[model samples]
Target chain A: MSSNSKDKDNRRRRRSSSLMYQEPPESLEQQSDQAVLPNLNAQWVNAKGAWLIHIIIILLLKIVYDIVPSVTQETSWTLVNITYMFGSYLMFHWVRGIPFEFNAGAYDNLNMWEQIDNEDQYTPAKKFLLAVPICLFLVSTHYTHYDLAYFMINFLATLAVVVPKLPALHRMRLAFLNPEPQPTDQ
Target chain B: MNSSNIGTELPPTAVAFIESAAASFQKIPGSAIVIRYIRSSYQNDPIRSLVELFLFIFAVRYLLAPAYSTKKTKNVHLTEDEIDELVEDWTPEPLAGEQSEWEKLENDRIPVIIGPAAPKTKLQNGRTVTNLASYNHYNFASNPELTAKAVNTVRTYGVGPCSPPGFYGTQDVHMKSEADIAAHLGMPACIIYAQSFSTISSVIPAFSKRGDIIVADKAVNYPIRKGLQISRSTVRWYDHNDMEDLERVLAKVVKEGQGKPLTRRFIVTEGLFENTGDVVNLPKLVELKFKYKFRLILDETWSYGTMGRTGKGVTEHQHVDPNNVDMIIGGLAGCMSSGGGFCASTEEIVEHQRLSAAAYTFSAALPALLATTASETVTILQEEPSIIQNLRENIRAMRAQLDPRSDWVICTSSPENPVMLLVLKEQVVKDRGFSRQEQEFLLQDCVDECLANGVLITRLKSMPPALGSSPRDQEKEWLPRPALKVCVTTGLSKKETEKAGIVIRHAITAVMKGKKWQR
Candidate 1:
């Protein structure tokens, strides 16, 4: 017992002398919380506002599409398709967040919102559930007259906000991706 | 306000001009004359005849456009990249050593020190700090009678009762104050504790225990949250002020309990939420309590001496019977103008708290002086019932002076509430491109301006900003800072109450207009 105690004391002395610091592990919530912009919770500064601005732009285009009448035909379909694609790219690339619930035909991803900020990794199948809302919305535009393309454009634009959240989806880190995981000591 | 008073201070000439203008303005209208035509049309027909009379709406809407648009009111709209820039600009310096700032505070005096609750507390330099953003509502702190009682009791009892309530600490004064509270609450018995925060913190754990479940508001005060923590029970937080959400949560609790033979459930809420300055819907809360068959523990920490016919609290204010609530928890530290807290319930529940409440069994008793102070203040409430009206009137005047839907300012609290919180609209904060610190600093500057101009206001402290926030999205880092809290007392005059709104508004606009954020 005496020998063991001395050994323990010597080990402590050496460890203390080394002066090496061991940082605490950050919680999944903390890690995910720092991974993106915090302002997404509020207005204007977060992905919500960016999404809103894109949505507004699409709405304004809908007014033009309605007024011009030329864009509604199959010929202007290319124009609408191009606009929707670009809108989707801008939204998914620029915005950094998504709404709590993105509703589909008979399904809702409401419960997934709380888990989004957790470091609990998700798959493409789970992340693909986010695209359902736009698919459903675009279908509605086909039956309606108010430039259904706007809804598709608006929905696709906000996709960038949620895509980075899933680890498997985001790429090209140098292009503007937040760090994967920092040391988190601070 | 009438068209009759428009021309030559009489309607006859005005009516003639309006009739003639209405008949001819249509022919005179061209491209640039649209507004003139509308005006001429409005003046000619006065009431726009019978059919198109409301065409004047265009003119009014056009005039009100600047005041109504959120975009027009806001000055800053940072792009996503700009937001990332600000968030990354100046990160909080992380400490080098192992000890955190909170741990260091335990060993050292706070950079800012607080005096005992008073009308005008002395600051570090012995300067009078009237309202450097204090929302303490401790009106009786510096009262001559209360202060004298404290002095006399300090000389006699020597500050502390020196024993727990279970021991020799139950003095005559303690019994008297408890009795006074019981009488005031219209309950069978009341138990007092060493401090106000501990009352709820101890009661929840003592009553609910580990296996029980507690349904609470998401925005309850910290003490209540701490109590919920101590209970170690499954806590379900309903959206703040949303009865529907509460019902949904309670229904789920009932469903969960259906499978269990014996389960304890409790609903906790505050009579007046301190953070939001809004009163809870007591009638709806009581209805839910019966519908769910869960016991209710209502914390009246802020509402106790500020509501009801004679400050009997939300029970009387909302006409809910005291018997409906299973337990009433209150803190005397604020508004009641004393230290310590009390739990009022039936004899059995009160006995359970006295026997098992950790704060009561382990903590020193409340000083005899504070017990007397509380009893004395209750008497003051009885003697002067009009003081409640005075406070209500001051709040009403303050609200009346500011447009409720103005884009410039937003009030989180209702007009009737004595504790009013006014914040710049979120859009306004975004427009100014003010960071969280910049916003707080600007609010402080506004308060200082108000103080210099002889009116004092306070900006509430927001939750500490999260460390390691995203530097990439600068706008995403802009936290919605807490609103300024301005509390009214019976001592406040009607004129000052009216002036308070103008003072606050002017101070905010002046501060916003004077300087620009560096980065």
Candidate 2:
């Protein structure tokens, strides 16, 4: 009985050791340590850079607005506004890491890798990036009786980016806005 | 485009045919009073109403396109090479099965489903047959004494609350349940909803308006999307689980609304992804919410009764402050083994929703038995910690047994949650291509096999991609990544777990062997 017990113990030890030596299962902890942290640093840099560009573009637009005192012309003013809106939207995407392909059907692919690798770490960032195309599409096309295909494409693009991000943002906002009170004696 | 021509072009025979067809259609099959009422209201202006009706139908069809077109099937007429290529692209074997003594031992296992009813037996010809599908009244984990106390309260209180909360519907039991949930969640107040489905569909749009922006997860439940559609709120979707995408959307919304008036901005998420079984990072999500200044709403339907040390849900599991969440919605259907939904929030928010939310104001209040049962379940969950431990053990055992062979079988994991995804063998997929009808058949077949081996399972279909009005051919077909979602309730036992594992293994192995079952 002693010998059998010793043999079982040895087998268990051997199994555990073998498992330790083998590669660990792919997990969020390990993946976040590698991909999410490093990617976050890159994203932060991009965000700062994009913010800088946004400031510069706003300054340039201010200059244009200042020089064009006759800004009441509907056509030219609309053109200027469009350019500014497009630039601001692009800057948002640059910071947020919006995928180039904005089709709603393919939106799942946009954050597929992040969700698989490190869901918690990447979910918020993906949610933020989804807003760029949607805001642009909505503001740009609100007045137009465009082709059905054009309207549908924009609608799809907006939904693709908006739907996924809304949930994450919702949770984040809820947390920030409604901080639990620290217990204190009156 | 002529006004007369638009209503014209109907021959006398065609008109007669239409009249006859409409009459027969009303008599045939099943027709609801609501449908007949709506149809009769539009009968006066037939031509104009017909066009409007067709348009409305088209819009409804488009909105629900994802649910409609998700079923794809393999063409039987395809050439061998084409079939081979299609199979190779769409479905591939994730793991190879091993034939061993252990496998053989597992093949004979049987599982039983337990519930509130008595065990049933059947007679086959002249012989007595023992029924294995007896899972009614399997509340071994539930304290009978506690259940009795709750039932006594319910019996004394009567059956249902009957009216919406806005009316004279708020009973003492309902108030107590709400208070209990709020205290457990550590939130200021709680609001009860008839169902979690209505809670999301109603409350979300109530908080925001047309000009307001809503950013949500693409994989949110369908009812939420339907609510957003009716609200006409400009929605921006971020990639699932991508925090960067969320920040970008926030910045864009803020930036774009600089000159224009921006209304309320809201963000929504699920506590634990019901489909993938993935946990959301509550702390990080909170941080983003603070930075963005958008109201956050989390649906903790799947997580409330299963996650955390105390089963308060992801907020507790992640060690985040529950009070940090603006609104926390959860359903008491699965884990509580009862029915009803509760939203934990501030008193002001609860009051506002009770007053403004249409569903909350209109829907019938929860039945008394369910409220009593759920409240009792909560008390049991809080007092008896070992139930969670046993569930965890069952989850761990199942994972350890299944993960090694995940390649041969398709299994998706989400930490220690009771839910797990079981992917069927590639041969099953080859036999049943991506068609919705075929997928349903495959699911039914799998359930049958499991039942034959004495295991019961709840089957679910995946949320399809949103598609708008388009011709059938033009509409993008979303294929469900076929999986069997396994959920372990408090009623499951160690013996039941082992038996279920064996039964599941046998069902999977039998299917892999290409053994056909009668439909």
Considering only chain A, what is the TM-score of each predicted structure?
0.32, 0.33
Span of ten consecutive residues with least summed lDDT in model 1 chain B: B63-72
TM-score of 2: 0.53
DockQ of each: 0.01, 0.01
Clashes of 1: 14
Candidates in order, TM-scores: namely 0.55, 0.53
Query: How far off is residue B38 in model 1, in Å?
Result: 99
Local error of candidate 2 at B130, Å? 13
TM-score (0 to 1) of chain B, per candidate?
0.71, 0.69
Could you tell me the interface RMSD of model 2? Answer: 20.1
Instruction: Put down candidate 2 lDDT per residue, B1-519, tens digits, no spaces.
Output: 133657776677877898898888778666566465455545454553454355345434433433211113365698989988898899655575465453353343323324432222222222222222221222422557756865786778776767887778878878888988888888999988878667777777667654467888765666667666645456888767678888888888788667443468888888877655677768888998989888888888878978887779999899999888888989876566667688899999888888777678889888877777777878877887677877788777666655555433556546667777666556646664545545545555666577655455645554644654444632343233556666554355566666676676666666545545323
The residue-by-residue lDDT of candidate 1 on A28-82, one tens digit each, is: 3434333444323322322345445545654565455657755554324334445
lDDT of each residue in B1-519, candidate 1, tens digit only: 264555645557776888787778656747346654445434333322222322224223333433211112356989999999999997786576467554463234222336764445455645654442443443566577878877887788777778998999998889999999889878889999889988998899887753467899977877887788666566888888899999999998788676443557999999988777789999999999998899999998878888887887889899999889999988787778778999899999999888778899999999888888888888887778887787788777777765463446677775556777777778877776766656666666666667656556676653333455455543533333367778775544677567767777677667666755323
Please list the residue runs of candidate 2 whose C-alpha ends up more than 4 Å from where it truly belongs after superposition.
Answer: A1-186, B1-143, B424-440, B462-480, B515-519
